[model samples]
Target: MEKITVTAQRKHRDNLPTGSVFGYLPRVVLAAMLASAAVLALIFSEVVRGWEATISAFAISWVVPGQALSLGQVAYFGLGTANPRGIDITELCSAVIIISPLLLLAALLLLMRRFKIGTVFKALAAGFLIIVLANVIRIVMIAFGWDHFGMAGFDAAHQGYGSAFALLAFAAGMIVFIRLSFGRKHKSQQ
Candidate 1:
């Protein structure tokens, strides 16, 4: 009798109520859906571009201190000097290009339900910060190139290795997101 009862108890202990294990599911799903929808809508909006340009303007100004800068808003974001010939921050050149993809990826990771919402958020915050800093650095470098190298410098910095650096930054952010979110579980499982 004792052996039979022990075996039954072990079987029950092995089975977990799925509901209890997934207590955080609702919040995760809601967050993932909201982010995915917003990301899609922002694709056709100038809000992100404007924000990116504004941020870049402030960053570049800080880097080149003392120069009078101008920002063109309403339709698109064009950051230039007082002379009017500045770099136009188009959608393609915007940080949105990289950040969007990562945002989508983070949403998908959230939907997977393997991580807690707080962990996912922390990972995303760190990753986005890295990408933003990299982008600012890229813009600052472009301004530096234009100041010292002229149009040739601008062309090289904007379309050359500068773009490559931005891509690398995105890759780094993705890695950080995955590692931070999943690493916790992987260790516990082992």
Candidate 2:
């Protein structure tokens, strides 16, 4: 009889509505989504290498004058045909790493708002392009600065302009996400 009573009590305790486990679902999903994105980005990095070659060829032909340009040349002014002062990939990678997380956070916010998946993806893609473009420009500027004032100038640009541009890109991405998400709704409501 005691065993039965204890069993019943245990069952009752077990059956008493367990707190929702789904509370963490959103966070888990967000983490998984971001992880998957990062993995895919890494996988696609190889593909980007090929694309980079093509782009480098094109940039050399159209954008910058003189002989074929190298990544180091374009990244900074010290290497290759760019100038004696090239920027290099380390600075470019640093800029990308710093800016990418902010952009990702902004994207997650838009995603959490229940925006359409397609819209979110489009916004994310646009944001990435903006960052890439801005980074390229930043590298160019750093290279030019290095050419003019040497490493000190390059370092200054990295600290000041690079940070400012990253913030601007992040803000721009968020703004674009918000605008894209709500603009349709606003028009429909009107």
Candidate 3:
């Protein structure tokens, strides 16, 4: 049998498919397409519009002691307060909005040859879970603060603390994904 030289092996590897979408196309073209797709997902998010209410309902149900009742998109709370509180679940309060951008960024990363599709999927999955959990905690904090300390506490948690926490969680999740995707391993040459 003939021995294959390192140059020959390198050439063979170069010819093989990279497994990216439109890998045969120019990298710049592919990158632009992927970026545009990501932007479009945010622009026309019909599927994601109602997800805020659904996810909030599920999260509120999980956080509260009893069943958290949602009439339409509003979550009703306050057991023995002067009046029952209705927390309206809006796009700003939903995890789906935050998760969508991450997913799009992952797709862009895949297109730009930063990592494999499997890595992107894994990262996106983990990020999605984190975002959902963070959003739930935010809502809970707002509701609990409102019930206990009145409007000031609610505003502080909703406008100040909870929003910051959610943004931090999203950033942390994305950072983890990037590290997992691009962290290089060195192979010792014999």
The candidate maximizing lDDT is 1
The residue pairs in collision within model 3 are: none
lDDT of 3 by residue, 82-178 (tens): 6567678676676657766776677677665546566666766777777777877788888777766789978998999988998898788777777
Model 2, position 183, has a per-residue lDDT of 34
- Steric collisions counted per model: 0, 9, 0
What C-alpha lDDT does candidate 3 achieve relative to the native structure?
Answer: 0.67
Tens digit of per-residue lDDT, candidate 2, span 1-190: 3432345536666764445557445545765676566555555554443443334334434443344445522322223554543334542343345344644554465445345555655666676666666655555555445556767877876777765776687568656655664436432221
TM-score of each: 0.74, 0.54, 0.70
User: Which stretches in model 1 have alpha-carbon errors above 4 Å?
Assistant: 1-25, 37-41, 65-84, 185-190
Error of 1 at 52 (Å): 1.1
TM-score of 3: 0.70
Native-to-model Cα distance after best TM-score fit, residue 74 in candidate 2, in Å: 8.0
Question: Residue by residue across 1-190, what tens digits does model 1's lDDT show?
Answer: 3442445435665673666747556766767774775586366546666666667767666655344343552211123444334566677677677677767777777766556677877888888898878887888788777766778888888889788898898789888987887745232221
RMSD of each: 5.4, 12.0, 5.0
Judged by lDDT relative to the true structure, which candidate is superior, 2 or 3? 3
lDDT of 3 at 107: 61
What value of lDDT does candidate 1 attain over all alpha carbons? 0.68
